[model samples]
Target: MPKQLFHHFNKYLELTEEHFQEILPFFEIRILKKKEVLMEAGNMCTHNHFVLEGCLHMFFLNDKGTERTVQFAIENWWITDDLAYLNQTTTDFSIQAVENTRLLTITHDKQGQLLKEFPQLEKYFRTIYQISYGAALVKMRYLFGLTKEEIYFHFTEQFPLFAQRVPQYLIASFLGLTPEYVSEIRAKKRS
Candidate 1:
């Protein structure tokens, strides 16, 4: 585990150096290049990845063969097909790196063993999951309540770094807008 992993855990719970060291053995560091697929659709998702650096997005191809990006995980954030990972089943989603990314990944078996051994980690994970769920709810509210342009503005306002670091096309996919519409919105802002 890296120093960043320690800091990420510390944000949720007070983990002593000794406790953190014990937890490190359960995680492995994996690196991916830009556009690399970490996990492809139709496979069983075995690992939950926490981004130590760079960005990753979870997406699926819709009926029309258009990529629909549903989630992104940046530094200190986690990404996985939750239902698939939890049930140890195949998934319809793929996770891809948007940039060169370093991740701390834990296998499902190891995560289970770790949580059993370290009860404190259960609290940490619980907090993380609760916050993640809340964020999903909020994202849904924004997606439904706001107009497409308003959604873009809200997304940019909420995650300014994503607006800058991620390509407009990917952002547009995530926001359910076309790249051309995103361009128009940018031009509107400029004017």
Candidate 2:
């Protein structure tokens, strides 16, 4: 693992060398095959994952059994069932590997211990949650108000790599559109 990944943590809080060493020991590296489920609805989320490579998606199945993607996390991103993780209850969402993925996982118990042992880690996580919350709020607003074409363009502009890696159907679900609508939008954009 490139120590550079730690820079994401450093952005929010200053970690002393000793603190970093203490925190590092608590994280375990995990690899997942594509389509593997990390956390499923009705199961407690045991760990929070920081992606080192590939993509993961958080989604819930509708009453009709269709998957509605709520969020996608690519390399250098974090993914977890935030509500379940914090409440220590069953998750409503499912988190799955969209591609073969490398992740650094920190268990809830270990994370709590890390907070007590290294206050800097607490500060880092607080900042991360704040950003995640804000982004989710914006995405919800856009999904309610924007057209499929607008959503596609916005996502492509902000996360071109994700647009390239994720399948169009998944992107359509994220945008609250059908696959045909997504295909139509892409065709229009190309012309």
Candidate 3:
């Protein structure tokens, strides 16, 4: 079991090292190259990935065939097409590596089994879901409440790691701005 995972679980619920060991086998470790596709749109979403390092983006192609990033998961964060993964249905979003990444992946069936075998883990998952949902809500608020430049600045302010680590194009996609606009903003910031 990764000490990082153990520490993450402890953030929500206390689990003995022994007990955590028991649940550890339910997950698989995955290493992805930058731009690797983990899940594609129109495929059944079977796995939920937890980031151990690096980053992942959940995005969809727009009507014009431009990629629109909806969410990103960095180290210690979780990424999945939530509804599709839960319902075992096809996903509208595709998940991809933003950089060379390491992740812990659990299939939907294995997750269910893990929960049944370790019911206390339900609290941990539930807490994660709640936090994810709240973050989504906040993202929506930012989308509506902030200007494009403002949104970019606020997001960079809140997550400087993303600004430094993720490509500016992906950041622009996430903020619903054109890459050129993001370049303009960055140029202005320097000047």
Candidate 4:
């Protein structure tokens, strides 16, 4: 678990063995069953989870009570409500395991201490957050502006494994399309 975490961090910033060892204690490994909710709406998101295996989905209900998926985290990715975690405030989002999962989670206080102990990690996390934010911006534009077919194709092109790993309804929700519409599109493509 620590090895996987080390590999993830090393991609963004180089860390000395001593520094890595020092920060290792701050992370706690968690195993979650499929459909298990890690964080719920109206609760503070106290920890950021690093996926070692399986998938996680972050979503919230819209006014019509439909699930609107904001993000998905697979292996080697991080998942959390950034604003809630940072501000220690309640979140409108819920995070859950899409499959049985292995995670390394860091609490807000531990994250601060770990960063203080190894400043290089700050660069790694900042880069990760920037990328996440940029992706969110692009996704927002696509959701509102793109045609449903185009959005589906673009999503599959970018994250091909998502169609296999996630339920069709959830994928449809994320693309702002109805599940029946997604099925129709798939049928049309097959024909």
lDDT of each: 0.94, 0.85, 0.94, 0.91
Better of 2 and 4 by TM-score: 4
In candidate 3, position 62 carries an lDDT of 98
Report lDDT (Cα) of residue 173, candidate 3: 97
Better of 2 and 3 by lDDT: 3
Looking at model 3, which ten-residue stretch has the lowest summed lDDT?
A: 1-10
Lowest lDDT sum, 10 consecutive residues, model 4, at 15-24
Candidate closer to the true structure by TM-score (higher is better), 2 or 3: 3
RMSD of 3: 0.9
Clashing pairs in 3: none
Candidate 2 residue-wise lDDT at 100: 97
What TM-score would you give candidate 1 relative to the actual structure? 0.97
Superposing every Cα of model 4 onto the true structure, what RMSD results? 1.1
For residues 1-191, could you state the per-residue lDDT of candidate 4 as single tens digits? 66888888888888777777888899899999999999999998899999999999999999999899888999999999999999999999999899999999999999999888788888999999999999989998987888989999889888889988999988998888889999999999999
Give the alpha carbon lDDT tens digit for every residue of 1-191 in model 2. 73545777777777666656666888999999999988889898878999988899999999999999999998778899887898788898998899998999988899888788777677778888899999989998887887767888898889888888999889888878889988887788789
The TM-score values for the models, in the order shown, are: 0.97, 0.93, 0.97, 0.96
- Number of clashes recorded per candidate: 0, 0, 0, 0
Q: What is the lDDT of residue 168 in candidate 1?
A: 93
Clashing pairs in 1: none
> Which digits, one per residue and each the tens of the lDDT, describe model 3 over residues 67-157?
9999999989999999999999999999999999999999999999999999999999999999999999999999999999999999999
